[model samples]
Target: MDERSALGLLAGWVDAAGDDAAVIDGLVITTDMLHARTDFPGGTTRYTAGWRSIGASLSDVAAMGGTATAAVAAYGAPAFDAEEIAAFVDGANDVCDLTGAAYVGGDLDDHDEFTVAGTVVGRVDDPVFRHGAAPGDAVYVTGTLGRTGAAIREFERGNVERGNELFRFEPRVATGRRLAGVASAMMDSSDGLARSLHQLAAASDCGFAVEWDRLPVDRAVDAVADDDAARRELSTFFGEDFELVFTGPRAAVESTRGALGAPITRIGRVTDDGVLADGDPLPDRGYSH
Candidate 1:
């Protein structure tokens, strides 16, 4: 079964079934695992891997509109390289620093492949959820899209410098906090904007109508693809951006954007109808693993 299906089978026993993180007595907890062979690219550094692995779990806390408190990781490798291991720890600490969390250290083990499993703990006063959206809510996204997709393409093409932009994503923790009071529903776009919207719709029991022209396609995509359609595909369907996709009243969303001084873009509106792109149906496309 897919992750979602597996989780669904056990949903009845959990306090929160479909959110990015689980909450218990105000504490938010989440975990993520990464395999070096599959997740790390040729040019990816140990530091980046460690950072991304820890950041992935922290991003779930952000999705819940929580402040990170602490994180721990489980690292496994065939053999230890002192320098690389130090770099990995440094990277993990760096991400924890960015998210205002502490790295409390973790366990190490020997394995045939390199793996990192990171878990983060956090707290939220009023946690935002994926199921609270209602008809007429305004859909918004923070930062530009397609950066990750473009970055990966650039890396494959041997442009490491440019590709690094997408490889290192900034989790929208601050933005998520700022939006907690206003957003009716919230989630991070680690699964691509289109898929995120679909997931939100499923959770909220509503629909979204996105305006193609309003999508904040990352400028970096221009370097990767020449055609507008291809650019749109990458921006909308490729995952790993770690940006926030949320919904709220139009006024509240606008005010929050102004107050936070962050790049929040209005992409669409929630409705009773199913998801659409400029009035047409938006295809279900994104990263699935």
Candidate 2:
């Protein structure tokens, strides 16, 4: 079974297993694990790896509409290099600081390959959930899409520096908190926009009719794909952009415009059933871990 299937099995017994993060007594908590071979591409620095790993868990906190407070990581590798470890911690600290959080340090050990498990803690008064979307709610996405797709393309084309630079995504901790007041349902697009829409549809017992032309695709996607079809494919299915996908009342958009530092684009509206993009069915495919 894949990760989602495994989580399905666990959800049978775990009440808090369904959401992006577990919330208890106003505290939001989540954990994530990554491997070098599968998660980190070749030429990825130890620093980037650290930031990406911890940033992932923080993204979960963001999905729950929480203010990230602290984070920690357990690092494992077959061999230890002093310089690499220091750089990893530095990256971790930088990412946490960017989100107004702290990197409180973690454990390290030898392993068969480079691996990192990250955990983040946060606080929320009224957290947004994935299953709260209403039929008339407007669907929105924070920032742009296809950033990771462009980065992967650059990596394949030997533009290692630019690719690595693209990999350093900032977790939307503050954005999520701001959206909490307006968002009825929310999630992170780690598994790509198409898959994220499908998941939200399933959770909220609704459907989405997304406009192909409305997606705020990243400018970097143009360097990878010039045609419209290819650009849409990359932006929707490539995943790992770490942007927040949410739903709220149509009127809520104007209230959040001046407050959110990032751009929020309305791409669609919640429907009675069936996920569709530009009038055609959109497949639930994306980055599977």
Whole-model lDDT, model 1: 0.87
lDDT: worst 10-residue window of model 1: 253-262
What is the C-alpha lDDT profile of model 2 across 18-64, one tens digit per residue? 88899988899999999988888888888998899999999999999
TM-score of 1: 0.95
Instruction: For candidate 2, report its TM-score.
Output: 0.97
State which candidate has the highest lDDT: 2
Name every residue pair that clashes in candidate 2. Answer: none
In angstroms, the error of model 2 at 184 is 0.8
The clash count for each model shown is: 0, 0
State in Å the error of residue 77, model 2: 0.9
List residue ranges in candidate 1 displaced over 4 A. Answer: none
Q: Per-residue lDDT of 48-122 in model 1, one digit per residue for the tens?
A: 888888988888888899999999999999988999889989988998898789999999999898888999999
